[model samples]
Target: MLIAFNKPYGVLCQFTDESTGPARPTLATFIDVPGVYPAGRLDLDSEGLLLLTDDGRLQARIADPRYKAPKTYLVQVEGEPDEDALAALRRGVRLKDGMTLPAQVERIEAPDLWPRNPPVRFRKSVPDCWLKLILREGRNRQVRRMTAAVGHPTLRLVRWRIGDWTLEGIAPGEWREVPV
Candidate 1:
């Protein structure tokens, strides 16, 4: 079985959280399907499409970086990105780990998305803009780091697409069975 889940912010990618702090939300809170596991991870702070599958081979294909499955995000970033900044992102930005694979990035109008709980901060002086970023690599906080490297820190990150699947009809905290 394959599932496309719209993961909400503040929800852990795993089924459980072992930390000693106050109880935190996790996949288990939303997904109750037995034997299904997340194919790839979406950070606790990031929101959007997360795939889960019961088939190991299918999960590997979706999650493995070697497959280069394209993941698309609509990012809200601080400051307006100039052409140079966009070019840098398109050409690949150097991060602490290494230079990332060149990404497909473009300035886009703010997407119509569900409101984030607690909401992204609003600044009166600093200009902000939206970017459509498509990447083939999945490194820890890569999008946030890349934008920061280009002098535009990400304010909000939302995964809109992964490979052939999308968050089209999935609402936040909702999941649906999809064909593999």
Candidate 2:
């Protein structure tokens, strides 16, 4: 079984919370599918498409970086990026982990997206722009860090697609099982 979950911001990716702090929302609250586990993770601060599967081989194919599955994100950054910044992203930016693989990036119009609870802050002086970034490698906070390194800190981040799956009709906090 394959499941695509539109994970909401501030929600934990895992089914259970291991932290000792006050409880936060988790996948268990939304997903009731037995034996299915998240194929990959989206940070607590980020939102959008998350894939889960009950099949181990399918899970590995989705999560493993070796598969080079394209993951697309719609990023709202603080400043407008010129061609130079876009080129830098395309060429690959050096992160603490190492140089990132060249990414597919382009400036795009703001996506029609669901409203985020505790919405991203608004700024009058600092103009923001939207970017569509596609990456094959899954690194922790890589997209956020990459944008920040290029002088445009991300204001809001949404993973729009993973592999061939997308958040097309799914609303935040909604999950739908799809045929594998």
Candidate 3:
């Protein structure tokens, strides 16, 4: 079985919180399916679609960088990017880890998205814009890093699609099972 969960912001990707410290929300709060694990991680601050599966082979296909399954993000950035920045993202960007693979990137009008709780901060002086970025590789905080490297910091990040599956009708904090 495969599951697609629309993870809400501030929720940990893992099902358990091992630490005895202050509690933060986790996948357990939204998902109750047994024998399934997240295919790839979404950062605690990011809101988006997270795929889970009980089959190890399916998990590997989705999570392993070698498979190169595309993940698409709708990003709200702190500044409007020029053509140079867009081209740089399309070509590739040098990061602390290594050069990122070329990504499919384009400027987009703000997506009609559900309102985030507490919401992203607004700045009058600093203009913000939307970007659609598709990457085949998942790296730690990669999207945020790439945008910052191009002189535009990400204000909000949402993963809309993974492989052929998408958030679609799934609302935040909800999960739906699909056939593998």
Highest TM-score: give the candidate number: 1
Better of 2 and 3 by TM-score: 2
Worst 10 residues of 1 by lDDT: 36-45
How high is the CA lDDT of each candidate model?
0.96, 0.95, 0.94
**Cα RMSD to native, each candidate?**
0.5, 0.7, 0.9
Q: Looking at candidate 2, what is the lDDT of residue 40?
A: 93
Model 1 agreement with the true structure over 1-180: per-residue lDDT tens digits: 999999999999999999999999999999999999999898989999999999999999999999999999999999999999999999999998999999999999999999999799998999999999999999999999999999999999999999999999899999999877
Cα deviation at 178, candidate 1, in Å, is: 0.8
The residue ranges of model 1 lying beyond 4 angstroms of the native Cα positions read none
Model 2, position 56: C-alpha lDDT score: 95
Q: Candidate 1 lDDT (Cα, whole model)? A: 0.96
Q: Could you give candidate 3's per-residue lDDT for residues 20-53 as a string of tens digits?
A: 9899999989888888899999998999999999
Instruction: Report the C-alpha lDDT of model 2 over 24-49, residue by residue, as the tens digit.
Output: 99999999988999999999999999
> How many angstroms is residue 51 displaced in model 1 relative to the true structure, after the best TM-score fit?
0.2
Candidate 3: residue 166 lDDT (0-100): 94
Error of 2 at 170 (Å): 0.5
Residue pairs with backbone overlap in model 3: none
